[model samples]
Target: MATSEKQVMVVGFDDHEHSAYALEWTLKHFFAPFTSNPPFKLVIVHAKPSPPSVAIPEASEILRYTEADLKKIAARVAESVEEICRNKLENEAIVEVMQGDPRNVLCDAVEKHQASVLVVGCHGYGAIKRAVIGSVSDYCAHHAHCSIMIVKKPKTKH
Candidate 1:
């Protein structure tokens, strides 16, 4: 079978539409071609940011938020991503939710999984905002260990 030489591919996911669209496009464009060539395994990764260091004066409130809570949420999000791709994907997909900087986390996952490609959606960041906040897509494009595909949403007519 073409699937004998299976390779791993990673897609950066969020609960948002752009992320969903990226997954759809990947399945349609990239994965569909897998049947003829070597089959590829898909992994959707979400890098959940850790809680912020806000100045909440109440120690009790801070105590209420635990690592377990964050991990639970991350697991739920991972499941959702898996659900999105379940129907169309040829094989079962792996959903991983990690905590850290998104760019670094995704890159690490690619390296760890030995993925052939990393797919992400462009958030339409303008020059100034991207300059200020440093776009994750931009960072991963340059930094990811594997090949990267940045899917941009087409502008809709007003």
Candidate 2:
């Protein structure tokens, strides 16, 4: 079948433990018994922060260095995601590194990929923290065109 014919599942990955857990959980629950033909096409998205616009000469130089560092981070993130998928289902996935706020990037990816579902890991932030920093999952739940699944890592036994 053509790629577009299959339902797409966009997974938000940020090189964080929570995101990794979400990917693992999704694979275990939905793609278990690893068939040659899974139900949905997996697409992992990593959103990199956009460089700030600074007018000062020194700031511009700093921004250039930061841009390079961001690229390195993106590469590492892609590699980690690939390793995770390889170890789990041995399945192939498209990994994209986008520049923008995660909430916007993820929602845009869903629209671009025509995804049927979007899976994101929750940071388990308190109300104040979530309000201040903002929650990507919460934003996506409201803005994304597809169904949103916010996976929260279970608390470890003390």
Candidate 3:
């Protein structure tokens, strides 16, 4: 990581927990060198749920977001990301709001942006839950071209 070359893409979701922390961690840990110098870039991705997954609740079908609603939602997601990185990221992170599966959108961004690293947070699912749903963190770890870091939330003892 030199002053002239630094490009990191951080993916975020509606939830502001471990993934957000991981995004910050990516900047502080992985891309520290560039932050200390110059020529650094960070891209934050906020993705909307896809069609089948984002469908209306069970019952008589009622239309959810039309074209306009979708636009508004995307804009809001981008805005939220922008706000988070406004003064926090020293490298001037770029925020993007996309609509689709989180993993797919992130993978596409990684390729399109030529990202050096991809960072995301894990939900910390139990063994059975993970086996059932298939964790995004697991998917990225396997699919990402570059290095992947999955930030795990610190467990609190009851």
Q: Per-residue lDDT tens digits of candidate 1, residues 1-158? A: 24466778899987677888888888888766674452577888999877666566775476457666777778777877777667676656788888898899999999999888899988888999999999989999898888999998778999
**Model 3 lDDT, full chain set:** 0.70
lDDT against the true structure, each candidate: 0.82, 0.91, 0.70
Inter-residue clash pairs, candidate 1: none
Residue 86, model 1: lDDT of 72
**TM per model?**
0.82, 0.94, 0.75
The number of clashing residue pairs in model 1 is 0
What is the per-residue lDDT of model 2 for residues 78-111, given as tens digits with 9 covering 90 to 100? 8998898888875688889999999999999999
RMSD of each: 3.4, 1.9, 4.3
Better of 2 and 3 by TM-score: 2
User: How much is 107 displaced in model 3, in angstroms?
Assistant: 1.1
* Alpha-carbon deviation at 147 in model 3, angstroms: 0.6
Rank the candidate models, highest TM-score first: 2, 1, 3
